[model samples]
Target: MTDTDIGYRATRRTVLPASLRLRYRLTPWWVKVIVVYLLARLASTVMLVALASVQGANPWTGAHPGYFDYASIWDGRWYDIVAEAGYPKSLPIGADGTVQQNAWAFLPAYPFLARAVMTVTFLPWSPAAVLVSFGFGLGAALVFYRLMALRLPGSTSLFATVIFCAGPTSPLFQLAYAESMYLFFLMLALYLLLKRRYWWMLAPVLVMAFTRPSGLAFALAMGFHVVYRWVVRRRDEFPVRERVASIVVMLVAGVSGIAWPAIAGLVTGVPDAYTATELSWRADYIGHVHLVPFAPWIQAADWWFGLFLQTSPWLGYITLVTVLALFGIWMFAPSVRRLGVDLRFWSVAYALYLLAVFFPQSSTFRLLAPMSPLAGAIAQPKSRTYRVVIVVLCLALQWGWLLVCWGVDGLDWSPP
Candidate 1:
């Protein structure tokens, strides 16, 4: 080839990437967020549709169910029951006298909204549920960008949203679940808190309380935030009125956090109805046991180690402690600290809350989606190679999650 031909080819190659980057930079911020969202949903749709094509007769649907049918499989049925029949006047009791898996375990917010959509659009539970989830997922993406922009540069904030959209549990975004709804409100609440819009924060806080089991975790974050403001009062100037208002909001949130259990107990004659129903799901792995504060993880570890692996349970205990310690240290990393006090405190509080109450299992990854704010720290590094690698890894894990957790493998124990 002539030297001129070689130079022209090199110039064309250089100009192509630069032109694409320029166009991308020129796009509006909201459009960029929506673009990544569409891309993520497209990729997830392909995987779920492929799974549906091969899905055999399961509890919820038959072989070769469509996309909406597949998305509504696992917890969707429970939501449907809630929407159609409402929570039971009497809890379903098993022969063992423990609460059986019932509609009481699910929060009413997502299903209530789905039923509303059904009323308006005349669609069935499956499609209506998917629509509600998708709408909330879209809202979550938009609010998450605004929240991230509060502390990070615009590009970093957008990348964090991308990471969040493509995360393993992101399938929940399109599925018939409450995770998407809860996440939207959670990000909005956090954004309002950071802006010091205390009164405006109450709206999201109340909605989030009824959406999922996140009220207690959010209260803890707010409580720590109050203390943080007081500690840095000299520099940050936490006024007396602001402190009092903050405390009031925190107390109100804490009460709201525990209100569902009380409501469940009152409606049903069975006191502890909510707690019992929740524990029933875990009973599959560890048999029937009373709920104890800060004991679930240890109990779960012993079950996995001693029963499943036939090994010393002490090693499991040691490993759990070590992992928790490492997680605590990770909170102090420079990148994580850059997320600001509200995000950082929320991370620590939520992690401890999960460590105390959650049993480590397949659902654990889905639960971790609440901590997606930490994705900002991961997005902080400006390495193009690293960003591409992480995006690929996220999608790969998405496939793994669908196959291992969401798919109804024979005697499937993992539920997304």
Candidate 2:
């Protein structure tokens, strides 16, 4: 038989054995889902345990020391306070009964969820919150796997899961932070967008807005996607009514996402509450001190270069080069552009986010974490050498942030 016929026959016969057919029929969908879910969970657990062990064994402790002790280091304490009681009139008093001025410091959704969990389960808020974060992170990884599987082969999807779940930044999942939850919403939004399920995408986009201000960026990015499609596709192919509906959906999604923060600000009468809370602590930080046009340059430097080197100097230098290299590859490689993914849209959104946070007085690393997944998705390399370099750099930057979080003297940029 010719090669084509032989291949075709092989494909048909592969499914023919009665025993093999029975095995396939007997396999439950839930069983497969559970197995993949457990795999991701197991990977996250391992990383968290490793982080906890290192912190527990370390001799020199910083401001807040312990496995997840850093929770109280920056915005973490604020979240805990918010969970115990609603946003206080003013910051809570210390153990010594000293009152502080920053009461509207915490973000709303995470702490609110933590408070609900604490009230319902009667468990300590810290551990309970961390557990919830962990579960959400695992779910996010699974969603990422599902999304990637749509665009890549099964093996690549599995590799992407490993890169996402077990990579250096996995420790974020163990903390009482909102990265995991935000990521869960992000993945859900992306899945809905890919499936063209516009209404489903709106729900998670709304949840994301409450989780963090950057959630609005996702909605805007989706809006951009809709516009790009309309601009590129032939006008005659899409009816005017359908085009109008698409525009309406994008507007509703974008407005709804921003509406949450606007409502929160109005209720609190803190017009710039989000920005104010973020910058309150770092008001004197170099990036925030500059103000206006100059602030963007300083912030970009701090985020793209400063934070890494300042926190972990050696890794910082390596990461700086890696960042440049990845950007270089993306700009110069035609193959990467031709890969059919909207890498440019994500890259632009990320740039806007970086600029938006420059003067916000938050740690560049924490502010930049949400964009890492998008970066990873778009940084796929065409050549073997490019792949190796990109992967190494990504892992280095990710792990470097983990060390910075653990080792820095004043590392306190959790999403309160």
Candidate 3:
């Protein structure tokens, strides 16, 4: 990126009051990140509280539940169960003989971490789980800043961090969920991979694998990283040792990605324990369909098309193809390319992973949060108006997402 494209964090010319501007200029970058995170979380908490005030009694909470109670509902309660009762040895089977929803689907790392916190702090599951998310979210923001700084200017990277913190899903940071913790580990892993710190990457990569279903996507990224390096070896040196390390890491990542499933199957004495549990969540929407690789999107497309448009399902396929084509173009755009090849590789790999296995649903946004490095691309242009517009849209959409997904309508179909 050109110097003109990304100026210093604070310009000599500004509209701010002199004293406040001076204080802002003197503050540390990390401190600024903390302030942004805190302020963002505060805003999200406010939104959640407002929703909680009106929320009617549901399976998870009483009428007009408080902040922690509301946040602890949904997937947070699942994590709480995993932490308290642990996974079942025998899978719960429904009358139809399909696997019923159980603790096996939720990963162990985040909830166990919360359990540790609960032991020491004497806090209940709701508070402890939210604390885990809050703390790790701050960590994620800090690491995200450094990762963006690797390629963009410090100011631009910081702005990108701002975008991330204030993004629509910022509410996840305060909820009793694992997304914030997973993002911390995922971003740290990507940062290490980008720096070619092969050995160091193992820590976050393995941990994040258990934190979320990230192993396969990261392994795919490693594969692409290796090929990209080999293709450009004439300009960028790709040594034998580096290649060996990269290949080994890729294989390890693949193993880590599937490790949880293997463990679930073994312990439960059901060969498809993990996959079946995950599929059970969607059975309510798509019925008891068999799991097929790279087929979920096609099926989801038809399902969604038939549900909404009540017309030809082929239109859905064409729309999916068009979206993929546009996304591919965006991946190669000059602004995104500037973030480096590894970031792009991760984006593509994550996209492919989602396409192969995920059905289009309300949870898709949360799943896509791992590929958020592209925020740097948006924050690159040094236009105050543009930045303000982007941030404003983020804030507005924050409320929109809360209204549509977070708020519990009676028998709600949409979930965040």
Candidate 4:
């Protein structure tokens, strides 16, 4: 059977009876995405509950955490605080002439959604946040599946979806985090851009800007597109008006990418309000630094060295080797050629952006969740045994990551 046929049969076997399955054989591809989501949810929930069962005081609330409690720990706590109390009017500063960690550090999109959901349904912030994540996570998966189908067959796309869900940081999608919502907007923006719906892409781009600092990746990709059309392709094919319109759209996207931080700075009366709050988390580094270009590499080096030098120096080398390997893949992998120029450019730029701005920590991999679409570009295994082994390894690592990094009582030391 073809890969598409295999996917259809697997979906049919899940819900429809043998007699009725034949009648519904032409089910929409999205139903299969939903099936994949349900399966991933089940696996993640089981693993999360297993860890929560061994919990002490939940760091976020200082209460004995159940499953919901575990989901809202770490950065989720800050999101909850923002949702419940809202950001302060003035920028918070510390005694040493530095910014302090505050709600301004987090983007407001996810918390606003959670608060709106809570108002509509009369649920607490914890469950409401998870519900928002679950719904948006499903939508993101559906859009992601469609995007993958543009380049992959049904079975391979399904495998990519599975890999996205079973990624080590992917469980955050089922929690009270903004990863899912941000991804929903990010992928939608990319998909719209890929379809060449230039003006229509602005809506998601605007929403994405308020979701995370990484929204700039979209603008960067569009800027590359402009350079390709005007310079590389020499602008000979399209009409002048069409070319001008596309350029306008890209310029709008570029500004909207940094609109959130700019607006926040203006409102808070601090020209660098967002940067200050973000840097506050690393105040212990014993140095003054601006959020200028290439700062995160130095910050990541310092953080990782401090973390591993006393514990296990080998871990630092392993981390370096892993990053270099992924960089090599982004640069030269033949499979990446199939992802088209837009996604390929976006993925590499996004990776470099993360390395430059984000400090490496426990939540560092979680920040990379936006690159889940790259799973579609991964070379597939030729043998069933290899495929099975890869899936098993992915799921095992996810569970292991949660238990080791997320479940401990004092994990508040690092962002989740």
Q: Per TM-score, what order, best first?
A: 1, 3, 4, 2
Q: Give a tens-digit lDDT track for model 2, residues 50-153.
A: 55455542223343244555433345666776777666433333454433335365567787887788788887877778777877877887777776665665
- lDDT (Cα atoms) of all candidates against the true structure: 0.90, 0.59, 0.91, 0.77
Query: Candidate 3's residue-wise lDDT over 43-150, tens digit each?
Result: 888888998999998879889998889989889989999989888999999998999899998999999999999999999999999999999999999999999999
Clashes of 1: 0
Pairs of residues at least 3 apart in sequence or in different chains that clash in candidate 4: none
For this target, which candidate reaches the highest TM-score against the unseen true structure?
1
* lDDT winner: 3
Steric overlap count per candidate: 0, 1, 0, 0
Candidate 2 segments exceeding 4 Å error: 1-73, 89-105, 235-245, 287-294, 299-344, 359-362, 372-399, 407-416
lDDT digits (tens) for residues 1-416 of candidate 1: 99999999999999999999999889999998998898999999999999989999999988899998999988889999999989998988889777888888898888999999999999999999998888889889999999999999999999899999999889899999899999999999889899988878888888889989878888899999999899999999998889887887787788888988889999998889998988889989998778887899999779989898999999889999899888888889999999998999888889878876787888999999889999999999889999999999999999999999999977889888
Please give the lDDT score at residue 378 for candidate 4.
Answer: 62
TM-score of 1: 0.96
lDDT of 2 at 29: 38
How does each model score on TM-score? 0.96, 0.70, 0.94, 0.87
